[model samples]
Target: MEQNKTLVTEFVLTGLTDLPGLQVPLFLVFLVIYLTTLVGNLGLIFLIWKDPHLHIPMYLFLGSLAFVDACSSTSVSPKMLMNFLSMNHLISLIECISQFYIFASSANTECFLLMVMAYDRYVAICNPLLYPVVMSNVFCTQLLGVSYIIGFLHPMMHVGLLFKLTFCKSNVIHYFYCEILQLFKISCTDPRVNMLLIFIFSVFIQSFTFMSIILSYSYVFFAILKKKSAKGRSKAFSTCSAHLLSVFLFYGTLFLMYVLPGSGPCENQDKMYSLFYTIIIPLLSLFIHSLRNKEVIGALRRIMKINSS
Candidate 1:
């Protein structure tokens, strides 16, 4: 047992591709995506901070989303870029575990945060009279704190169990980063406990959160229908349309990546799905909120006008 603990000090990360011709192109493409993710998310955070008019609960949640996206992208992209640029695509065992923990925690945090955002929309649209009271500053802060607490602690259990496993098998992980499933695949010991824990957490976290979002939207829809004036209905729908779109994109990719049964031997397809959720979704999220949101656009225009004048 002791010898097995010392057996593997590092692990090779098999990135998205091995083709010599595709390496540079892939690197350039992801570099551009990473940069966009940074600018978009950070830009949103800056706008939220600078514009006092935007200091509301919806924007507050959006800011948190942007912050999480930036952190999650940073957790993976730098090491991924290094692998793309170098012949040796190796990550130390400690580094791999650390990356896995951060990525998983951030992913979980985003899931809960989206649910919170949905609830915020629900209150704004369904119970306008109670919106301010329900989503007061203190309550919003508490929700955010809970999201991070659950996100960070849930993954700690997985990492603790992971460290107990002996890795006498191949050290080459079959993914771009140290994903939980890929790590489990490389474990020589029985992974039933880990798998069971994953199943339970997935049910408790993903299922519960997804269902809550659905319920919130359902109420929001009915409330929108109750609005008599067409302009009022339009105004209400506009507020939530962006959030609804974001929810679809985030949950859709997540479901495809995790819930769907894999089509036989299609490792690349799985990786592609994972890429959408990890890389593409964050980039899309920025545009979804900023482009569709009139307030965000107005705030940007105001900032630009002030700067130019």
Candidate 2:
């Protein structure tokens, strides 16, 4: 299959920038990011598991998200860090594809997890009485199962479709990772079909999840307003605000990158944007959602107390 489809066996990635001045600084910066992401995400998952108070559906999804974010960051950052430290950015065709597969699946899985979390919130707020029964352990497990199944399955289609394209344009990929658009640019074969499929997939996945989250929150908004107590309304706002911010940050960046074409913050903006979503987003997720939460804070205190005792 490869003999026919790909002539560019080993592609050289033009790592972030060609400037020698920024290499060490960028390396140091991303190094800190990678270490922080790993520790924070893994620590959050452990915190959730160790704390009995966090055994609910929301925390379950949160833990899964931390897992997926860790996976997403791992798939790209190690290679990116290595590339930053060394001049060797050469990756085999198989390696590139495998890397994207992992990253893409992790990303798609994140979309689903966020969607399910939104639904969890919907049930809890909209159907307050039924939420306990509806979002029971068994049901939550099933939801998680589906989120992962679809998450993994979604990228297989892209990779399968990608394999059909032949690459002959140039072996130098101009981004940090084997990004889909970068791949399409190098393919000698017509990537219109591939682009179309990607567009369709991106639109469907993002829109469906984005719209569902919006709808859920819309209902949640009204429900919050209907509450008699000002404190209850204010508390609800505070609780959901963080979740909504994370959602907007993830979906917003993705939407802009895909829909707006060339809106990067600077030259070689693709690399910058990719770094943001792939590396920075994971770190942001922990702070924007889990770390800011009162419950997570309480759980941390409880765990610390136990360890100290």
Q: What lDDT tens digits, residue by residue, belong to model 2 across residues 30-148? A: 89998999999999999999999999999999999999999999999888889987867999989999999999899889988998998998898889899888998999999999999
Q: Candidate 2, TM-score vs. the true structure?
A: 0.94
Worst 10 residues of 1 by lDDT: 256-265
**Candidate 1: tens digits of C-alpha lDDT, residues 65-170:** 9999998888899899989989999898899989988888888999999999999989998889999999999999999999999988999999999998878688
| lDDT of candidates 1 onward, in order | 0.88, 0.88
Off by over 4 Å in 1: 1-6, 260-265
Q: Which residue pairs show collisions in model 1?
A: none
